[model samples]
Target: MKATVYEGPRSVAVKEVPDARIERPTDVLVRITTTNICGSDLHMYEGRTDFEEGRIFGHENMGEVVAVGDGVDRVRVGDLVCLPFNISCGFCRNCEKGLTAFCLTTPDNPKMAGAAYGFADMGPYDGGQAELLRVPYGDHNCLVLPEEARERQSDYVMLSDIFPTGWHATQLACVQPGDTVVIYGAGPVGLMAALSATLKSASKIMVVDRHPDRLALAEEIGAIPIDDSKVSPVDQVNEQTDGLGADRGCECVGYQAHDPQGHEHPNLTLNNLVQSVKFTGTIGVVGVFIPQDPGSPDKLYKEGEIAFDYGLLWFKGQTIGNGQANIKAYNRQLCGLIQAGKAKPSWIVSHELPLDKAPEGYQHFDARDNGWTKVLMHPDGGSHN
Candidate 1:
């Protein structure tokens, strides 16, 4: 098998690796067809995280099941399935409560409650950025796709992560049908939040970001794009809401939030969300915030502490929700929307390349290069495309 392996800071290589096979009775072997290079993957790619070299690098995955373990009763060989980024044991307490992202039984370390494929500090599970993926808890982790998924891999592939994560942001923010919502960042997850807000009938959707390409995509989806590079995002959001601020807010940039000058400020988006959301409004954060950043120049960020405006947050009486999205919690409903032709997340995809081109895709995406909104890799060398 061949996989995209993390080489070092801003580097990756696609090369032959040991084949992934069923290691347990509950495991399922998938012939990976479509996998995405997610924004979060950049954390490892940029050496911001302690991701080990030689580890595969993908989580957004969907493909055909080539083999299934005896214990897998629901998923079968030949079934097309989408594997959620989270590697959870469905019978765990957290998973039973639909908090699969924080499943207590998956992580190798007892202190860590959640696990993800190919993610640093998550678990030992290999990712599906290759020709084969060994899925644990097959019946529980695999979301069997409809027959049409074979042709709509790009859209369905999103079910593995971003789409559900975006929807989870809306849920955390408690976005009401007529509520006005503002989201920070215009990356894939942010755009998905905007899309989720739209589907939930948000009266007004405002997305704050500096990237012209990303902001343009938000505008195309009927969201009012607030170019923070040109003006104060808080002011724009306030002005659009007639000085009341948005009814709900979402933070999608996480610890990598920074200014136009390229100076990283981990607290930037949190403070912005506090100011842009109205008093008493709620905010949902789906961005990836690590516990530590040893390479950070900022003292507070080095310790994974942000000097957030907690005083103002409390004064405003705003409710804040932050965590990883439990992909299993929303994938089914989101998948239904896709199957019904109501959602098309594939609109965000800007690059489709074969598995061998993964390093190029990572380079362009990690640079945040213009026009690279999302990159989807076909492990079968464009056969799925």
Candidate 2:
């Protein structure tokens, strides 16, 4: 198989690698059609984490099942399926409770509780950024797509990560119809969070970001764009909500949060969320914050200890919910919305290249190039909408 191999900091290349094959009865072999380069992958791509070299680098994936293990009864060969970023055994206690992201059965380390393809410290499973992928717990992990999936791979593929993750943010923040919601960051996940808030009938949706391209995307979906580069984001949100703060807020920037000057502040977004939201409102965080950030200039961030505003939070009586999205818990319903022509996440996709061009895609995306919002790679030359 040819895969996008991570060589080092800000470096990747397409190289011939060992073929991925079914090694267990529950495994399924997929001929990957569409795979995505996610914002989370940048953590490894930028050398911010301890991601090993020579590993593949993709987690958002969808494809045609080429072969199914004998133990796989539901998913079959020739079925088009989208695999969630999380890999888990469905019979585990967490999975039984719909907390598949924290499943106790799939991590490489027994002390850990979750697993993801090609992610650092997640699992030993290879990612789907190649011509082929080996799916574990085939029947449990594969979300079989409808026949119409052949025409909408761009939208369906989002069910693997961002769309569900955005929806999960709203769920965590307790977004209700007629509620005023404010979102931090205007990246793909943040844009998806804006979209999710729109679908949930939020009365007012405000998206904060410095990028003109990303803020423009949020505006396209009817969200009020707050350009932090021009003014204070918290002030803008307060102005929009008549100084009451938003009813709900979401933090989507994670540990990489930075100012216009490009100085990284791991606690920037969380504290901003606290100040931007109402006194008794809820805050949902879906950003990627790891346990340790060795590359951080701040010593506390080096130890993964963010100086959060717990005193302000306690005084305001605000609530917070943070973690990885339980993708399996929402994929089915989100898929139905796509199938019914109610949602189209492909609107954010900015580039689609063949597998060999993955290196270019990563370079542009990691640099945060203008208009390079989301990039998708086609391994088998399939173009989905």
Candidate 3:
């Protein structure tokens, strides 16, 4: 099997590794047909997140089930499926309560939110970036796709992560119908958040970013695009809102956000969000933040004390929702929307590359290349595009 293995800071390559096979009675083996290199994966590539070497590096996956173990009944061989990025045991304490991301069955680790595929500090489960992936607790993890999933692979593939994540951001932000919403970061996730905001019928959707390309896409979605490069994003939002700010805001940049000049500034986005949001508004933080940075020391992130404007947040009576998206909680509904032809998250994807080109894909994505919104990788070196 070939996979994109993380070597070190700013290093990744596609190489042959052992083929994935069923490992437990509840396991299933899936041939990797579609997988994505997400913004989250950038953490490991930049060495900002600690993960062991030789580990596979992809989690947003969709594929056909090639094999299944004895205990698997819900999914079988030849069935198309999209598994959640989080590897929850269904019966775990947290999973039973609908918190799959913090499943209690997660293997012990000093560093990790819980078990995850292809995520550093998340778990030991290998990712599906290769030709095949062995899924533990297959019956619980795999979401059998509709009949058209094969035809709409690219859109369904997004259901594995970003789409659901964007929906989660909207859900966390408490986006109400007729409400005004603002989101920071026009990256793929942020853009999807803006698109998802449309689904909730938010009256006004505003996205802040310095990139013309990203902001242009925001405008195409009928959302207000605020180019922070020209002026403070808060100022633009306030000017548009008549100083009332938005009813809800989303933080999609996480810790990797940069100022207008492209220098890293972890708190800049959130601070802008705080000022651009109404006094009682909620903010969803979906951007990844970490204690270490291979890029350099960012003032917002200390060993543990990330420089956050909690003082202002507290003063403003703002509610904050933070953490990873529990992908299972939302993938199904989002899938139905895609099936209905209402949402086309695939629009964010800029390239479809064969497995062999993963090295180049990683480089371009790492640099956030122009028009490189998303890159979908397939094991066989081809795709729907």
Candidate 4:
């Protein structure tokens, strides 16, 4: 099998690797059809994380189950399924409470509660960015897609990560119908958050980013685009909200956030959100923040720490919810919306290439190239116009 292997900083290669097969009684062998290169994947691609060489590099995946272990009863061969980024065992205490992202059973490190395929420090599971993927705890992890899944593979595939994650951001921010919401970052996740907020009937949605293409996507979906590169985002939000600030805010640009001049600031979005959201309003942060960044030039970020305006956060009495998204918590409902033609997250997809072209996709996306908002790879020679 050919898989995209991480070679080093800002590099990847498609090389022949040993076939991925069922390794346990609870495992399912999936013939991957569609997989995504995520923003979080860029963290590893840029060598910001401790992701080792020779590891596969995809987490958002969907495919047809080609084989299943005897223990897998619900999933069957030929069933189209989307695998959640989080690898969870259904019987864990956290799984019972719908906190599957923090499942206790998948990670080898007892101190780490969650596990993800092909992610650094997550677990030993390989990702689905190849012809085959070995899915652990098959029945629990595979999300069976509806019959029309093949026709909507691009949209359905998003249920694996960004769609649910964006919805999670809205959930964390406590976005209510008719509430005004402001989102920082117009990347895929930020655009999805705007879509989620729109579906939830938010009276006003504002998205901030420097990229004109990304901000245009947000505006396409009824969100007001704030070009932070041209104006202070906080001032724009305050101006739009009549100086009361937005009722809710979301931080989608994790630690890799930067100014228009390309200087990295791990705490930029957090501090900005604190000022943009009204007092007593809620904020949700779904951006990936690392525990350590040995490659960081900033001393505090080297220790995986950020210095944001916590004093003002406390004084404003604003509440914040932060963590990786519990994808399983919202995937089903989001999937339903897709099946019903109510939501089409595939609108954010900018490129679809064959598996061999993954390295190019990674290069363009890592550079944040114009028109490269999202990239989906098809291992079986699939293509979308």
- Model 2 residue 327 CA deviation (Å) reads 0.4
> Each prediction's Cα RMSD?
0.8, 0.7, 1.5, 0.8
Clashes of each: 0, 0, 3, 0
Candidate 4, residues 1-385, lDDT tens digits: the string is 9999999999999999999998899999999999999999999999999899999989999999999998999999999999999999989999999999999999999999999999999998898889999999999999999989888889999999999999999999999999999999999899999999999999999999999999999999999999988999999999999999999999999998998788889999999999999999999999999899988877899999989899999999999999999899999999999999999999999999999999899999998899999999999997633
Model 3 stretches with alpha carbons more than 4 Å out: 110-113, 291-295
Off by over 4 Å in 2: none
State the lDDT at 268 in candidate 3: 80
Residue pairs of candidate 1 with colliding backbone atoms: none
| Alpha-carbon RMSD, candidate 1 | 0.8
- Segments in model 4 whose C-alpha atoms lie over 4 Å from true places: none
Predictions in order: lDDT: 0.94, 0.94, 0.85, 0.94
For residues 239-258, write the lDDT of model 1, one tens digit per residue: 99999999999999999998
- Relative to the unseen true structure, what is the C-alpha lDDT of residue 62 in candidate 1, on a scale of 0 to 100? 91
TM-score list, all predictions: 0.99, 0.99, 0.97, 0.99
lDDT of 3: 0.85
Worst 10 residues of 3 by lDDT: 296-305
**Which model scores highest in lDDT?**
2
Cand. 2 TM to true fold = 0.99
Where's the lowest-lDDT run of ten residues in candidate 1?
376-385
Instruction: State the weakest 10-residue window (summed lDDT) of model 2.
Output: 376-385
